[model samples]
Target: MRWQKQPVHYPYEHVVCYDLETITDQEMQDGSFPPWPRHRPVAGSFLTAEWSPVGYRFKLDTLLCREGREAEFYRKVDSLLPPGGMGVSLNGRNFDNAVLRLQAQRNGLFDLRNIARQAESSRFDVAHLDLLDVFGARPGTSLAELCRALSIPVKTSVTGGDVADLWRSGNVAAVKAYVQEDVIATYILHLHAAAWREGHERQLVLPLADLAIWLEGEPGLRHLLSFATCRPARWARSRAPALRAAAALAEAELRLKREQDEAAFSAR
Candidate 1:
């Protein structure tokens, strides 16, 4: 029988995992310090909220980066993510975020640069968690390897090198699927890595009581899996009573356990 994998230590309850598929690098013959983004088309992208209540469920979606609409595509993504919370990916710091910033120079995203700043920092930086950078910077460490190592399925049929060919062949849909799979795999890889580092205690640690707060919508990580319990829109706020009652129940349960322990001790 196969051994079960443990859950990772996810300190941040909120995160956004994303992956970008783009055309070949826009080469600048002159190797300048600030390499501006060239006219390369952003193939497409996918992102998930990484937050689910009492289960592994999440909501992930994709967006196509059509011709002449690079800025619009990038803007929607940038705005989709809120100010804080870590962004997880494989080599996102050096590659994905770099491409995003270069392309987003003309867009009006408020915190677009924050991804660059946080993602490029040390591993301890929670703002952005680039698995490649955190994992000893081993040269040529691809996503497929990490996924396989962690027992997560590498869902895509093609690799990054094949994106341009797929696009050329009118398989833009395939490219989107590929990129979306990468996003999902990245998130799974993170859970494994976190489990490796912090060890898993329980699955779907996010409490149902926090459902209202979670639905209230903080940007980034986990946007997959379907569950009717999570259907309520973010606009429908939860009253303090719901949150407090849950807390009160928990506190009472803990108190009862404590009392039982004390009574047994006294009898001894």
Candidate 2:
């Protein structure tokens, strides 16, 4: 596909927005509860993003693994992204990119020589426009807080602390659903901010169907899926065991809850 060098008209000219979910060691060991940092465990997830003009597209991506998937992820991401496009994130520079880079290095996916060259040559000169940074100048602004301020609905069903438990307890469907909601919320915030910057109040509201349609046209989804498809079965298998464990736990918990409810009803 031919890359479009010129900027598109309207709010898209300024930035692209993306969100990620990852499995950390803390989550896995702690049964999906908030992970402790000392463990330095691996994590993975399905990621999604919205490019300006292209709308909100979801991609199954990952972060932190024993396997060498980070290189593949970066390759896919780089392909979809324009060389100089501005990357807009909630607080991506400090958290998202840093975690990705660390995972890449830990997994031995990054070549130090190539990284040096990329840095020296400035070939990867994409500017990061962080929404958190923009909003940080104003006190009491956060991802959820910012969404509220801008009249955007929050889309996530659970907090990051709960993801490990959700996954460990075998709620894959729920985890996927929750992550997808986050992607939608992130996309809406991006559009809302972009519209605000462009002085268009009416464009601030994005319907879910319109967002899905917009995502359908994004060039990034194909790249991410293709990368995932190319990985070895071993990498995928590693996640399977933990996910199974999570499912088992979830089932037991559900059973216990059901019994408790039944007993309470009988007592009454």
Best by lDDT: 1
How large is the C-alpha RMSD of every model relative to the true structure?
Answer: 10.9, 22.2
Give the Cα-based TM-score of candidate 1 against the true structure.
0.64
Give the residue spans of candidate 2 off by over 4 A: 1-15, 26-71, 78-81, 111-126, 137-141, 202-268
What TM-score against the true fold does each predicted structure earn?
0.64, 0.52
Estimate the overall C-alpha local distance difference test score of candidate 1.
Answer: 0.59
Please state the error at residue 112 of candidate 1 in Å: 3.7
What does candidate 2's lDDT look like per residue over 61-126, in tens digits? 433323445566655544433344455556555555555555546657665432222223221234
> How displaced is residue 68 in candidate 2, in Å?
6.5
Best by TM-score: 1
Per-residue lDDT of candidate 1, residues 160-226 (tens digit): 7778778878998778767766776676556545644655312122232233244336344233221
| Model 1, runs deviating above 4 Å | 1-11, 25-41, 50-53, 106-122, 201-252, 255-268
